[model samples]
Target: MSEQNQDKHQQRQQKVKQKVDERIAAAQKEQGIFQVITGNGKGKSTSGFGTVARAVGHGMKAAVCQFIKGTWECGERNLLEKAGVEFVIMNTGFTWETQNKESDTVAAQVTWQEAKRMLKDESINLVMLDEITYMITYGYIDLDDVLEAVSSRPAMQSVIITGRGAHRKLTDLADTVSEVRNVKHAFDAGIKAQKGFDY
Candidate 1:
């Protein structure tokens, strides 16, 4: 074949393969169930909140159980609440910020109990467990319990678990996993977190 004809043949082959892959992926998307967003970088909870907005936009019920860093005002929470999203704030903030392990543990337990309820509720189409990895890392909640709750959730229900240091077991069980890596952050340059951006 001539050079131009060969090139055209390869391009046509690539297009066919791309279409096949797209169809395969669509076929595999049986029912959205579990997702894990984790990393040292920011935006985990932000991504989860985005999913909450999407779910609520589609007229689906959604809930958020904030496991840590709940003392500060969250713009997403305000907007989501107004949109009819249920929220359960642990209200203990970060462990380092609180400087009390017992208090953090107590708050995590309370939040975990509520999370369990939400996970089991078939009425809720989307559930966001914001900053839950910290509770798992600190042993504030049982890993097995979390695994079981996620496993038993309704097949059509979607869950977003977000935080840093997500457990390997959780990632293994997630239908989709995304880790946001920090390349450059303004906080590294001594810029304090700005409202509506960080908080």
Candidate 2:
């Protein structure tokens, strides 16, 4: 490249670096962040689990409350359980499949009790509520209870909520919200949910 072009490139990069430095310097607070991963696409729970794994990798205490799950084995749970991450499963599977609102409500409430305990426990560094939005949607769990527990959680405890069509209140309270759009999915093409990949 010509010296003039190279000089211009250097100047542009220098300005970019300055902006980045300023932004970095401006962010000085250290506190746990609430993250919401929701949308019509897959991978919401996967993303939440990934964050739990990241916390475990850093030797942080983490707990996961899996709503609307059955007895099926989870790959992430298998690994994280061994890593000392506490797990509370609703064990009700899909609400449509269960077709028993009374029993499902009971199960949801029981699982939510465990989640509330984890949220109040200051020792736990992170809590992942997997597919919890469905419970709220079905009225199986109280939305106010969830909001209160999360909002009152330990200041250093981070929470991750993942599901489709998350409540507006949750999105508003979250520090980071990510929406996964469904452009295409293998299930629509008659592809079965593979073990490790889907679970």
Candidate 3:
């Protein structure tokens, strides 16, 4: 590249950096953020677990309440649990797989009690509700209860809600919201879900 072109590129990048710096300087809040991860694409729960791992790395206590996974051994479960995260897997499987609403509701309610306890615990800095959207959609857990629990939790305790189809109310209440879009997946192309990559 010509020296003139390189100089122009550097100047452009500097201007962009200045704008970003200004925005960072303008923001002044320090409270814990409420984040919602949802959509048809994968990685919602994966991102939640990533946040849990981040919190643990920062010496912060985290609690994990998995809502719709079965008895399968997940990589995050093993890693987080071994790292001393307060982990709990609530559901036996997806709703269709279970074919038992009554038992599912009972299990969800019991598990939510534990989650609520963790929410109220100020010492726990992060609470990950993995695949919790299904609980609300399936009527196993009330949306109002979830809102109240997170709202009344410690000022510095973050709550991460992960799953598809996050309700508008939940997103509106969140400080940050991200929807992962599904463009393509190997499963749709007659390929099976592989270990580590899919789960």
Would you list the C-alpha lDDT of every candidate in the order shown?
0.91, 0.93, 0.89
> What TM-score would each prediction reach against the true structure?
0.89, 0.95, 0.95
| Model 2: lDDT to the true structure | 0.93
lDDT winner = 2
Query: What's model 3's lDDT at 104?
Result: 92
How well does candidate 1 score on lDDT at residue 194?
92
Candidate 1 achieves a global lDDT of: 0.91
Residue ranges of candidate 1 with Cα displaced over 4 Å:
1-29
Task: Give per-residue CA lDDT, model 3, range 1-199, as digits (tens).
Answer: 9999999999999999999999999998888889999999978888888889999999999999988884766888878788999877784877788899999999899889999999999999999988888899889999999999989989999999999999889999999999999998888999987878767
Q: How well does candidate 1 score on lDDT at residue 85? A: 95
Instruction: List model 1 lDDT by residue over 1-199, tens digit each.
Output: 9999999999999999999999898886567579999998878889989989999999999999998878999999989999999999999877888888888888899999999999889899999999898899998899999999999888888999999999999999998999999989999999999989997
Once superposed on the true structure, which residue ranges of model 2 sit more than 4 Å away at CA?
none
TM-score of candidate 2 on Cα atoms, chains taken together: 0.95
TM-score of structure candidate 1: 0.89
| Residue 106 lDDT, candidate 2, scale 0-100 | 95
